[model samples]
Target: MNEYQKFREQIDEFMQHHPQSPLDEAHRLYFRGLFYYEPSPAYLVMATVTRFSAREPLVEMETSTGDRRRYRRWGRAHFTIDGEAAALTIYANPYEEDFFLPFRDATSGKETYGAGRYLDSHRPGLRQLGEGEIGIDFNWCYNPYCAYNEGYSCPLPPRENWLAIPIRAGEKVFHSSSR
Candidate 1:
């Protein structure tokens, strides 16, 4: 198998042991729709971010309720997508000091979740790889803090993070027939 395949295998094994991850029960259920710890066809994207930034904290994401809520944007970074080059952002907000991402794309509401998917990009995994680089494995992209349950504030994806192309990489929308 190739290197990417090997990495995916490791991820699958990890997921089985840590299913639902560090997220709550609801969040874990939401993530299960997008990923599982088993061998199957998975999308492994190797992309780089062109423009990157790290916000001190305090970011916002508009909600379906028509409210603009602010959350901590501690672990923010920008990168490219499939060599196309884009600025990807991540929110460092885990259950207990975690990082997250909530974004929208052209496919939002149509192809994928209207609010976009969530990615748990913890720092330790890539620290050994070096700086200004990240591997946004769609297999890991699930839903944001809000998708699972209520009362939790989440950092929405900025307008810039919206991808015009359909990722078709990670978990698809829960209610969509396409999924």
Candidate 2:
């Protein structure tokens, strides 16, 4: 099978069988697969990264479970959907070189998770396109593990990352979160 298919299968397996899966036995019993919006080319974008100043302050982000987490404003990824300009902040772990992105679009409560979604930096969809550009495939976005289990502490998308436009790409809410 193709690499992407293999990767998806692996992720599905992990969700269903891995010890770290957010699902407890009761939830895992009925697990089928994640729901997703039909893949759209409109949301596969190459956004230019605008680095934040070294002195940019670290923001305290609220979490799904009422916890607070701090992340440095590493940079912003700017792109466009249709004719609407969009931008989202990229966060740094302060202790790690890795980057993170959490966002909420117009489709958030109605179509996706209410808590927002995440774009894994190491994923192919968020790959480095060039020196200061990164590919952001909305189809590859996924819900935080907190969506499934309240025990998980997931950072919510800050106001800066909330987009007015509806991004009808990526994973939608799982069976129980349709509300």
Each candidate's TM vs. the true structure?
Answer: 0.54, 0.91
- Give the alpha carbon lDDT tens digit for every residue of 120-148 in model 1: 64522222124544555555555554554
The local distance difference test score of model 1 is: 0.51
Pull out the clashing pairs in model 2: none
Candidate 1 error regions (>4 Å): 1-57, 64-83, 94-97, 122-128, 144-155, 176-179
The prediction achieving the highest TM-score against the true structure is: 2
Worst 10 residues of 2 by lDDT: 170-179
- Superposed model 2: Cα runs more than 4 Å off: 1-4, 177-179
Which candidate ranks first by lDDT, i.e. highest?
A: 2
Residue-level lDDT of model 2, residues 1-179, one tens digit each, is 75445656677788889999998888778787677777778889989998888787788999988889998888899999988999998888877757788999998989999879888677666776677888888878888999889899999999999999988887888775222
